[model samples]
Target: MPHDHQNDEPLSSSGHPFRADDDTKLSYWQVMEIAVRELLIEKGHISASQVHEQINRMDARSPANGATIVARAWTDPQFKAALLTNAGQTSRDMGFDIGPMQLIVVENTNSVHNVVVCTLCSCYPRNLLGLPPDWYKSRAYRSRTVVEPRKVLSEFGVEIAPDVQVRVHDSTADMRYLVLPAKPAEANGVSETLLANWVTRDSMIGVGLPRAPV
Candidate 1:
């Protein structure tokens, strides 16, 4: 029924006449609304306007958002430290949202720059990317990832410099994580878009670093 939206009347299915049961005690206005909708259905009242809308409402920057961030850090040490020190706010600064996961950034240090392990489980930052890949959650990866991240990275073909420190992080409870994968020395003056392509979910986890050239 044509909603006299002006009066704020509840619309019936398109344009059905209002119907009211004889014995029902609903107020006249309420009964009319029910009747109108019933009539609309009984007779094809005007076609219900399909309220077209989009469902892919989430704004995911990219899986490479991690890479882009790390790349940004490599080029700018202070920004890198900010990212390493505060993953949540810096992520928001880079046009990504990691606040809900209660992000915490752990930096690599002289003796132990960090690498992460959901040693007990696979808790990852889904808002920035999507679901954790199966391997990240698997016992094989989780159990072995912490014990020997460098070895795993090597098999995946990632060879961390022996001289550089490698700290390990275990994500659990309130915190979720993304890696501040150390920037490549050669990635000088790289654009965020181009740099992101090099970033991969695995690289962020220290199983790999963004690919160097190709």
Candidate 2:
């Protein structure tokens, strides 16, 4: 029932591909953003250099930043506590510009797993995880994840034990979430950089597990 194709496009018509933020055809909102930015620049309210720097900063953000945080949490209890208590501030303390977005971190324990979804739209913590995968924005994923989480996660190759609970968190424009994956047993005493390598984007999204140490 969660996934209904009632609103699907006609099979006779091929749908347009997903458009990138910088695609040739701009959305109304995208055009507005550009216009507002340029107006601010022309009015001396902001500088082009500052705009470029901000764009570069956003472009530089990736899952790597989140991996670093998870790795540190695995190695340092105090930081992990801080991260769980106040993710937005902790991320800022780690030098990530999360802007005005409110971030909430959920922990994956032996008895429970946390998954993220945006039933209404594709709201995500892009500041920490960069661009979302194309599949994440699909109607099926958005609708079915909340209804049949176990089946959905299994499709991603994640097997959750029957005894374990699956909790789905819905993201919104003002609030976002990140999953703090459980640390691997073999990761003890591993360097943060090496541990970071085990953290994948899907793991942070709760669709996959951390890679085993190799």
Candidate 3:
């Protein structure tokens, strides 16, 4: 069979999100990788390789897990305490085992304050928080998150009192952080699911927090 090399190129098909350019230097590495991987699969160099599928399924189910976690924290006082003390423990208490990178949450209350940053490098907590967005890791975020957290937070629609001290953290290791922002006064007794919907990723990053529905 005269196989069309170009047609049957990237990862067993076309329409892959990334294209395999044959002309570039990367093509050599790509071809080598493809050949080695296929051979490994054929020769049982690896066992049943269903990891990709499992990973896909895990990603698909992330929002539900996040929602469940968010709701419980909002409704339960003790649970919220646990989350503030140790974010990793809070995730586990909910029957969801966060692997590692034990997350520690800080609360922004009347007197105490907190801000999250990645100074040396971005070492976000991947267990409790899957992955930080592109912007979180950007130089701009790292630079500004520490200097003027309130200003940046305002961009995300959070307003801070002038008296509060913004304590910025340097994420130098694998440890990540999230902020247990003060519950909006209007959201008291809100359903867990509804409250969870209000908790946005930006809130966890300490840039923003959930709000009562308008």
Candidate 4:
């Protein structure tokens, strides 16, 4: 999707989010990336087939991978410890390469709530959770999550008690975070597969919780 380059107006005259700029205008990096890719293909340095394969690999990843890990952690104490200690290796053990980026798994407890955000950009644990949500990449979320996490989470319908402490984690290019949301009370006696189904993409991102099974 194309990003608008409007700087002055908060909202457009139509009362919608301002996107009055020309859609065809490309950012410097976007132009550079296209130029570089075309140059590489032109020189036969990399084949178009290789690029398509990489794109397919990325598209294959989804929240189910992260949810599987979370479900295991919820049921097995040892695995949970291993996940918290070395998230990268744990993910690799499950056949997911999290690349060189460090993955930090934060546990949401009864007294403490955890939320993750990348203030600079949309740095996320994409290897396990696929892509970051559009709202996560929004400037408002990146800025507001750190300042008023409780209120921000409340806006997402994730309410916490006044006594509960909210810890907001800032993800960077070198490191990313995944939230291990507290297992729902109703999830007791549920199979791991079913439990995995209960987890949502937003839950791993800490913007929401796992859905209760109907």
Candidate 5:
């Protein structure tokens, strides 16, 4: 039988008495996940070391992986063809794992610009491009990008010409996307290593363009 604690005060993690009305803002599922994980750890059902190792693996991934691939594509037309044809295999060939999901690489051309968004949730190419940024997972960005892509791009300081068309791609659980930003004219003679510096996470997401070499 449970004791009645209607009149008893609740304490936070810090042992400070807290009001029940305090807003932690965590969802029911999120709170439950934390509770379950803690309980499992306490019971020795799962090792904390295993959890930390997985976390470290995730943290190891970064935007530089995607930048290298983009730079290679810019320099090697044959590699570009292979990447466009099969991004997952191409990524594997380059020592990156894109998981089981299919990766679709969209090329930005003179006539068109492409942007990617996941309206439901942030289904990004995390294995290749690291974690998604905060704004990429926001509701405003997910909703507005599809509706008014040009306006969204403008907010990111990307101004497309009036004649160019803006195409927005919705990523899903089964498929992910990466934008192949057009190589800057000035980057023609740039070395692959140096060109990789021009590719940014936002540019790969299609929110912004790559920085021009100074």
Candidate 6:
């Protein structure tokens, strides 16, 4: 006997199967965000176009932007000094939209290597480096990076010498960190653009070294 299975499958208005996005309901905060934005627009406190533009600007930021900053710091001593002194101001001066978040730039040297992690949550430098990687937000990374940083780093293929110290910095909601990996020797005379390409996100996170210029 043929079964009447038509009702078992859920379909959209146009007779297509519903997508995962359609099946899932909006989250509480998501609904609240929409309501707040709409209310602000209704009260003329903010314009929709302004909101759109801001979203676009945030979406445009990525690791490439941070890489460019790193490249500039590598080539220019003054810029490097300024960056090390005041990371947030230096980034804003360079036209990055880091908002009001406090950014700390740690430099990797011959004797010290710095790594950043958010044990409580994923407090990342997203405005400059885009979204944090999955591992960065994982429990293992958050907890292990603080406890056994050297072993965690080793798993990522970054082996620090016994004599060299590994320093771990915990990122908070108000403060974020960016690791300035020691510039590769091969990148000494490279152009800023080329240098930027060699500066990987993992390098900036202190999990790996900058790619050698080929």
Q: Candidate 3: misplaced stretches above 4 Å?
A: 1-48, 61-67
**What's the TM-score of every candidate structure?**
0.62, 0.80, 0.72, 0.85, 0.81, 0.84
- On TM-score, the leading prediction is 4
- What value of lDDT does candidate 6 attain over all alpha carbons? 0.90
lDDT of 3: 0.70
lDDT tens digits, residues 15-117, model 1? 5445655985789999897687677756875433321111132344347666677667766778977877877888898787554667876544444445667
Tell me each candidate's RMSD, in Å, in order.
Answer: 17.1, 7.6, 8.2, 6.5, 9.2, 6.1
Candidate 2, poorest ten consecutive residues by summed lDDT: 11-20
Q: Compared with the true structure, what per-residue lDDT tens digits does model 3 show for residues 35-140?
A: 8877877888774456466566446544345545666776888887787777777787677756765677777788756778887777775555566678888898
* lDDT of residue 141 for candidate 6: 98
Worst 10 residues of 5 by lDDT: 1-10
> In candidate 2, which residue ranges exceed 4 Å CA deviation?
1-34
The TM-score ranking, best first, is 4, 6, 5, 2, 3, 1
Estimate the TM-score for candidate 2: 0.80
lDDT of 5 at 96: 83
Tens digit per residue, CA lDDT, model 5, 86-154: 998998998886677589899999998999999999989987887899999999999999898888898
lDDT of 2: 0.90
Error of 2 at 197 (Å): 0.8
